[model samples]
Target: MSDVIRASAAPKPVGTYPHARRVGDLLFLSGIGPRDPATNAIPGNEYFADGRVRSYDITTQTQAVFANVRAVLEASGACWEDLVDVTVYLTDMARDFKAYNAVWAEYFPDIDTAPCRTTLGITALPTPIAIELKCTAVVRADNRQD
Candidate 1:
């Protein structure tokens, strides 16, 4: 009910959740999946393009998820540098953990200052997608009387 920030460039949310929400000086973003916004379809190889929902492999999926996160952060008046925490939910962590890390490294090159995070394996998510990420960021005020 307060100020809400939406990432117009990010893939649209499938349901009633904002890409991110801004409250006070913090922004809490909803989990993002891997479907490409341009097509609203998951990326697939040559054999699976008949509109039959196909789950993208870990690499492709993680990339899309990150893109979504980036879009949300930008729209919320924040950036990756402002990230304070993150949560990753996986339907099958054991199978895709390494792949997820591979993609994560590209974005978060410096782990020393990476935001506080937690990863968990869950039974299911909104879609058949493989990975999802949610994050929180702080928005520093510019004209503070300090």
Candidate 2:
């Protein structure tokens, strides 16, 4: 059986989709951003209502994005260790890759436990956020420690 997972602690998806979908032992997550669930605010984003880009910090946004992804994983009865793969979308590759990689290493300290990852530089995202992460996780019965 398959199930859709919505995490109350994470920001609602920008489109009409659930945070994640589960089939068998795997959970596929939608692209997650750095928006705060309670305030709908994007951390480290400086795009104003006037459509001008100000200052965007990749490190700050990366931290928030990871937190949002964690909330979804937890809601789906999984954890960081269960993550098997991830695809990262970055608006500015030349400017942001170093900062993003630094934050990512903090989460996946060991190279052996780190998920396989692909990062793509895009022209833009649905929102003004600098980065978005889409991940797949292995959800074992014992991973539901919650």
Candidate 3:
């Protein structure tokens, strides 16, 4: 059975899925949006407060998505250092690529240990969120539950 782990710092999933899942040495994270837990807001997706959905800007949304990813990794007793792979899906790939890479570089400052990654342009996402990030990481040795 897989052990489900939820990151306290990340916004709660709006659907039926854990923030992450630990199976043996690996953790698989679900696609995450730029939702803020404190505000219960998704800036560029469906707006909760105004009841008006807004389109996402590349930079802000990308950073927030990565932040959510980091929160999940930390909550799962792992970190970017443990990440082995990442998959990014975007609605506007050509225009958003630069902004996405900039924030991505900030997150993985050590380019030498970069995880394998796949970035693709999709026609649409669940919401208007510009970007979604999902990852795979190794459970750190000291924090291994099993």
Best by TM-score: 2
Candidate 1 lDDT by residue in tens digits, 1-146: 54677777888998998888787788889888877878776643223477444445878888888887878887777877788998999888999899898878888889886888899999888876778888888877751112
Question: Which regions of candidate 1 deviate over 4 angstroms?
Answer: 44-55, 142-146
Candidates ranked by lDDT, best first? 2, 3, 1
Per TM-score, what order, best first?
Answer: 2, 3, 1
lDDT of 1 at 126: 82
Candidate 2: tens digits of C-alpha lDDT, residues 45-75: 6766896778888999999999999999999
> Using alpha carbons, what is the TM-score of model 3?
0.86
Quantify all predictions' global Cα lDDT against the true fold.
Answer: 0.78, 0.93, 0.84
lDDT of 2: 0.93
- Candidate 1 accuracy as TM-score: 0.85
Candidate 3 worst ten-residue window by lDDT? 46-55
Which candidate model has the greater lDDT, 1 or 3?
3
Tens-place lDDT digits, model 3, residues 1-146: 78998888998887999999999889999988887868866654545577656455778888788888889988888886898999999888888898888878887778689998899999888766788888999997897755
- For candidate 1, the lDDT comes to 0.78
> Residue 94, candidate 2: how far off, in angstroms?
0.5
